[model samples]
Target: MANRTSRDVLLRGLWVLGQGIREQPGLFTVGVGGSVVFGLLTIASAYVVGAIVGEVVVPSIESGRVETGLLGAGAAALLAVSVVKVVGIFGRRLGAGFMQYRLQASYRRRVTRRYLDLPMSWHQRHPTGTLLSNANSDVEATWFPVAPLPFAVGTVVMLVTAIAALFATDWVLALVGLAVFPALFALNVVYSRRMAPRQVRAQQLRAEVSGIAHESFDGALVVKTMGREAQETARFAGRAVELRDALISVGRLRGLFDPLLETLPSLGTLAVLLVGAARLRQGAVSVADLVSVAFLFTVLAFPVRAIGWVLAELPRSVAGWDRVRHVLTATGEMPYGDTELPAAATPASLVFDRVWFSYRPPVGEPAAPATADQSVDPTAVGVPGANTALPPVLRDVSFTVPAGRTVALVGPTGAGKSTIAALAARLVDPTAGRVVLDDVELPRLTAGSLARTVSLVAQVPFAFDDTVRANVTLDRPGLTDEVAWSALRLAEADGFVAALDDGLDTVVGERGTTLSGGQRQRLTLARALAGQPRLLVLDDATSAVDPRVEAAILAALRNSEIATSILIVAYRRATIALADEVVYLDQGRVVDHGTHQELLARCPGYNDLVTAYEQAEAERERTRSGTGTGDSGGGDPGGGPARAAEVVA
Candidate 1:
């Protein structure tokens, strides 16, 4: 895993660096040119110093003839060297800034694109916090390798030049200086090997901490209502502490190796000083040669040590790159649909043929998860520290909903009602069998066509931290204010929206925190309806709103001239009553399909579900009206939790 991870990360970082250079070659040229110029300047400065010591300093002292011309030449050389150094420094900063911006923009987009393309099922298995961390810290970590490459290359090149210069002056001193390079490189490699896995662990911990914190923030109401604030806080704190400790371990390793890397060059310098002095006493080396060699050694050691540090950092940067690559190079969920879909707004029929699916969650290792029900005991199938078995959430399930019609899904919690709706929208795909839209398999449909054809309003629609108009239109260009208002009216959201202080321009706050549950649900429905898709899939979207508002929304949906297929996944009787047919799912298979009256007559489970929903809603209403002795919130509902989904049409 470590070797593969390193290779993957290394290749990706270099590729990203190459892309940066490819995009803005001028900036790349500046960065590269500056480093090369700096290296040459150092060599020139060293040679000049040697010349001064030999022709000017020594002769003047020995013959008592101080030449002003020689002193002036030395000053001119020093001034020239300083000017080159200044230019190089300025060019490097400008080039690095441009490179950093260009690379970061591309990398961020790549990460986002990967996330967008991944199957919804893939998303379900991973935590939001980990994804957040991948986008932030992981991307930044990968930046190190790209940003340092120019410097690293320049350092290595300069070190080589210095070594060659030493050899030309005296092979003995050159060999001594060269000997330290191998030991320093070996030390770097060892430290890097040890740091890679630890860094990976640390990255994961950081993600976990972010995920926990995000969850807490998103579910603040639930935590407070349940009086579990302390518990959740402690859980988050534990994760944070884990990440901190892991980072400290990384810091400790860096601390140890950095000092050693710095000290190695000093020790080499000391050896050179001692040996050169002894040689000078024996008249084996000239004073000028010793001074030039020492000057060259100082210049070379700095770059050599810097190169060593960069090498040590490569593994960690690569570890981050591996994480990013995991997302970028992952097999996309389902597949793209390239087949042409009709441009007409008419509803498209959906068909399922021998469909089979299984959920693969992210587990303890880097392997794809196993089937959900096979009981590959994590402990038994573990590869020492690796475990990759996912708890399967779905299996072979098959059913169909004709075009220009409505189908209701009835099932126990986790029985795949929402999963089926998601599949219809191509949010996910079956492991086996095909889900076809208008006879064209979903995987063959182009993404734009599929999106236009299958619209879904999921339970709990995500509201952004933007104005109501932006939220309703969802930033889809060409969706005018007039059109947005029409959607709000259709979703029964206009009334509440108009009452707000800023009306359509009011900020919704993060996740629509400022709005009531019913208002947020209506806004989500309005956004889904804005596109006017051909097939509308709503997974219990009305669960949060009051019965009156839900009834009004249902009436509007039934009355709308959308001419589209609608699949409503709900436990509420009112929603089922409006459906033309009900498909009852039990376990992982479809048990029955028919109209409400027909299902009530033929399927016992269908009747039970309706009876349960009626009782639950009645209880809620009685509690709200203060006519019931039970708790106001119901604590839990009889028909199970109602997750508000989207209205795709």
Candidate 2:
């Protein structure tokens, strides 16, 4: 981003202030009105000094009399001035509080809404720390301008009013005080130029700190297991130190600017006093007029100081507003079709037509074989790249899940099985292909229509920090006990849920940490089953379940009325044997596809892979039985029996 000039910062700050008022006009009007009254009262207090001297002190000295009536009336008038001063103070504080509160509340909500509306690809580029800071600190910074804006405006009004009164008493003194105006504005511009880029850097560093902290916390388990606590802490501390330095730089500049604003009004008053003394000696000005002019300049100091406050915050406010606007106006929004999916009268038959897809690397990451621009459709009318070095994840892959038939996708790691499942669920769009469900293209279906038509249960599932029931329902309207219980039973989670202390209402810790790995997996499966989507997808969703238990769950799914077609990403024989057909994928291509037994007989690659998987499973079974029987020295102290089994495989 280009460095913002002083004028640009001030203009953007003003725009943010105007936007706040537009959002809450009534509150803004009340706040500004109060500040104006407050400003007038502050100036009036200065006038009372001249009033007391001119009206009571002058006459008493001339007459050489203790005039009780005159003295008593002056005291009464002073009391009235005090009362107005108190009211003005209250109004100014009230207005500033109101506007600040409204601005913070409105922007926080807007930032959250924008995050939800942004596409997943955009989210992939931005970290949790950036989004969190945008919602919290950036929002607060955007509203900081609101705190000083109204008071600053009122001060300007009071200064204009005080000057008119000053000139009415004596022209020369008023003119001397007016010189401070341009000088004060000049000070503000200089401060903005020095702080604008620094404040922007400061805000970015704050997000960096937040991101590092969040990463450390999120990966706490991994760090703990790897015994890398010092490494993680050092990573976080590095960013924290940088953020501290940035904030100090901005603070140092502010320190210099604020005092100068404060001292100028005092300097103007001194200038007026020198001129007024000479004018009084010439008998050209009365003591009362000279006193009034000097007092007015002293009163003007407050507003001048407030103007400094507004200017000091402008650069940070501009930086924050720019970040917020970037989010609101972000491009790459996933455009969905207007058409809804056809009603459930037709079977949900899924097909991938000569499909091709690939992923582009994020900024600063090593470039992937396929660049983003190279993600152009291979099927485009005039383009050609049916075979590029950047092999499409699902290169010219085509398959069909006939109505009511289950298909199992068996493949080595990175064979694009999960990618294919994502396409079927419409979580992502294919770069050069059409994924159709029930004869309708996947992209043509509205979000809601696609959601009900198919449901995907990811390999690693997430549970909200809420009750088990809420996690499944997502608090969706119209979810009933029967529906939830049936899904749980099919997922083989009913037994464990019934055994829990609080049943369905029990609160699950973040990511269901309170639950065992297999238990969390089952709960995730139950969540998808609860919705009873027409087409269900499982991407290694049951990998953690016990083999015997997994068999029961697969049996229940095969016999269930809810899903007509199921797309399973599987490696286990029990799972693949249950499928009506199998698709064998090797290095992203579908090598051969048939029933489990047919593939084992005909496809050499499929047989070897499955045999390897079977041998591995057999080793795991032997290790578990040996551990139970107190063999192998009653299990190794390293705490993972699977490591030994993996070595054997």
Candidate 3:
């Protein structure tokens, strides 16, 4: 039952991978042809060895004749077979290597495309390392079957050739060799069945370890600064040890199967030699026949070993193929609709209609037994038992931003401010209501059109490890040096950027580690500006820059008359003080909407929040003045300098 289930899954996986190969006929041809050539050469060598033993070695010994021609012919045939063998092996490697490169490259690109298609909500739950590993390591691991499979099947052909030769010599010995096959095949099937699940577990553990390591590496400074080095190390070491143990478990099974596969073939050879020797002594088999059978068994044994190796690796490769297919087969977050949003002659307005959303929480595990002795522990959580459900993240929410206007979102940490910003950008779609841009539904806009229409500047701006110009321009093209610098200047970042030794050409370390947080934040704003978006959504974009620099950037935006709608998500009153309108959210529900002055008089929650923000700023300044440190660990780097400057607005 187990063997059948594993084989079923294995075949299904191969069928999917084969579809990829079939779509690219040229690559498949090269791979298949190489294997065929190698198999033919292998069989030819075996035939030559058997012929030489029967026609030369035994006859010459019996007649006391020196058959020089036979010896010469055998030597020449061996030389020819050796040359073919080397050529076949070289071609197979070359072809398989090319196929692997092409497949991995193509699949990686497809995975990236799918990632872009998925919504921001999906990205939150999925770790960076897990996705990265799938696109790289998982895809690469799948290539193992591609190289070994065709050759292994070709060996099957060689097995048939050996059986035909044996039958021609003697039917009884041929039947004996055939009988050994079922036993050998049964053992391989059983071994593969049991090991497949183990291999799958090992691969999963490897992915988890990779995710943990990547997370740790990315947050190395945080872990060290918080004095959690030992804790982080222990966490990472636990995952690593689990992965190691899983691999070791699978390795032991592989060790046993490989030797058993090789040794079992020897037993078949032993049976042939014993039975053939007895037949010859009874005069039932000729001397030449006995010699040929022995030679055939010797040649055939190696193919059995090759077949066994392939069988052992088959499960792992199939499991990898399934993982790759999971990503390939997934339905990504691309917008679906029949209508398209038309290009605007001028920037248009945004409106949200009774918007409601909630995170699709992770599937929970079943409750465990209270004690360790119980089969179902009360404390342990296994896969869910179908009674529990996930909770909501957002409730009814609605707001609007007119063309060329600025709107602000203020709320507590978990009040769904970021989620709203993401929805506005169509980074995610609302569950119960529609977001319309210039009257067209958000989901109807094509990716290109949507990006041109809206741009997001988040609190934690992403920075690629590349030149400043490259990171700023990102995937967009056609921006000249002057245009890039102009955008940077407008973001209040040009001065610091120009101070760098390489200027805009300087390579930023991983995630812009070389730059200060404020600088990185400004660079992201510059990127958004470079897009010349119709709607610029800043989700705490100025959180790192000094309040002084942030005011300058905002002043530039207010004065430019660029006619782009802006949505700013922030807690600071000064950040949104100049906004034409404000939307105050409390516990995922919008409780107030109006001008800042209007809300201060009518909305107590809004008034209280502003008061708290002002009071906190005063307290922080007092502390800084008293201590002479001028640091609170959270203020915008440019905030202090900006606060001291006059704001024309």
Candidate 4:
């Protein structure tokens, strides 16, 4: 069973090499051609040396006279052979390097493109660090064997020809050649069997270590603020130590086999000398034949190890290929349609028709039916777990934001507000029913059309490390400084931007670390606005800004010349009042829908939640103002239904 498994691994490794060769056949051909040239010349050089020793050196000693011309000719011949051999080596190394690097680069691109193609749910299931490893180290390992592949191929040819030459010279020497080569191959097989598990373990550890490191670094603020630096360091150190040990195991095995592989050829040389001297005495072999065979064995030592090098790397190559292949062949990519929406400067209306959505459990969890009577279509919108019993985040939820109006989604925590926002922008498709834009189902619209018609500003804003102009415009064609400035002004971010040293040209640090939280949020909002989206979804996007600034920004958006519908996951009473209508949600179900004052008057749940929020804001303001008014009633400075009514009026 063990041998069968090892043989299977070997064949798989060879298949991987074949894939690389097929992808870049021209480079592989050039590499192998060079290796063959080098191999043939190497064997010839052995004979050349033997001939000089037997023909020129032996005769000269016997006559006690040196033939300078003959000696010079031999020198010239050796020099020519050495020079040609150098050219062969150059070609072989150059081709192998180019082929390996090209394969790595190509697969990296394919893996990254696949990441982009897969759905957000798919990405959520995977760790970012693991993805980074798959694209970098794993990709590198998959092609690492390519570097030694051509040399191994040429070495095989060299071994075969050398054995044949040995038989032609003398069968006794050929017998020695036959024994040593097989033993070398058998030792390599043993080494590979032992190395396979260790190499695979090492590769897994590398990914784990990367995952822990990325998580720690990405949450640097949380780590430092929570004072868990020691725990985080220990967590990272644990994984790093395991990776170190795994690599050490790999190195130890390689160390053990390397000398044994090198010793085999030297042993063969010693045996050849012992047998050939006896043959020379019996007139079975000449001095040149004995010398040539010994020289060939001496030179064959390093080249023979090329085969070992490839075999040893097969395990690592197979492991990396499996990981990389998993990413390249991952399913659940959100497929798009060819339907295009007609271009219109007017706002786009959004509607949810009994939309139901549920987050899929990761791969191994039990999958029960989502609903007893609701049948799921496997081909519907590429949403996994539609048949699973995972409680739907949104259940039979129906709402609409009419064109040229604003709708606020008022919900407590875990009320599916963000999910609704995601559906509004078509970042994800509904598990059941339809999310329509401009009277067309979102899934039926082309990605380009959907992107042009809608924009989503998430709660956690992300800014690229780039110039302010680049961040806002994102290199979108025809968006100039004028457009960016207009968007920035709408988001209330223009003043600070204008004060920057280089204005729009100034580089923001990674994730906009150079800017304050409010500044980053405003900048991201401006980015969304600059796209000129007809339908915009803000998933509590302005939470970082002051409530006054947030209200102003909403007012600016509503009164802007550009006609666009707005969907806001709003928490502040002021912001909700600015909406034309409000949808109150509780536990993923729409509790009620009406104007802010109407909900406050009729819905007890909405009234209580709003009252609590109002009292909290009033207390915070009192604290900020250093006043001990302690007014927590309805008539406090933080307004309830009456204040919301005033804002609306």
Per-candidate TM-scores read 0.82, 0.88, 0.86, 0.91
Over 4 Å off, model 3: 1-4, 13-21, 24-32, 50-70, 219-222, 283-288, 336-347, 363-390, 615-649
Candidate 4 CA-lDDT value? 0.86
Predicted model with the maximum lDDT:
4
Over 253-331, each residue of candidate 4 has an lDDT whose tens digit, in order, gives 8888898998999999999999999999999988888899999999999888889989999999999999999999998
Over 1-649, each residue of candidate 3 has an lDDT whose tens digit, in order, gives 7767798856754675576567566766665576667767776776677678778887888899969998999999989988977777776667666776787788889888888777676676577888887888788767656666556666777677767877887888888879877677788777777787887887777778888889899776566556778998899999899889988988898888778777776787788889988888888777667766666666566655655665666666676777777777765455566565555636668998877665544323332322332122222123232112223345567889898889999877788899888988987776666799988898777777887778899867678999989878875778878778888988888887898889989997788777766778888898998877888899988775556667788989877645588899976778768899999998778998999999999999889988897787667557556756432222233324322221100
Give the whole-model CA lDDT for all candidates, comma-separated. Answer: 0.74, 0.77, 0.74, 0.86
Tens-place lDDT per residue, model 2, 433-458, is: 78988888977778888877788999
- What is the clash count for each candidate, in the order shown? 16, 0, 15, 1
- Residue 451's lDDT within candidate 3 is 78
User: Could you list the CA RMSD of all candidates, in the order they appear?
Assistant: 6.3, 4.6, 6.8, 5.9
Clashing pairs in 4: 368-389
| Position 49, candidate 1: lDDT | 90
Query: lDDT for model 3, on a 0 to 1 scale?
Result: 0.74
Residue 221 local lDDT, model 3: 54
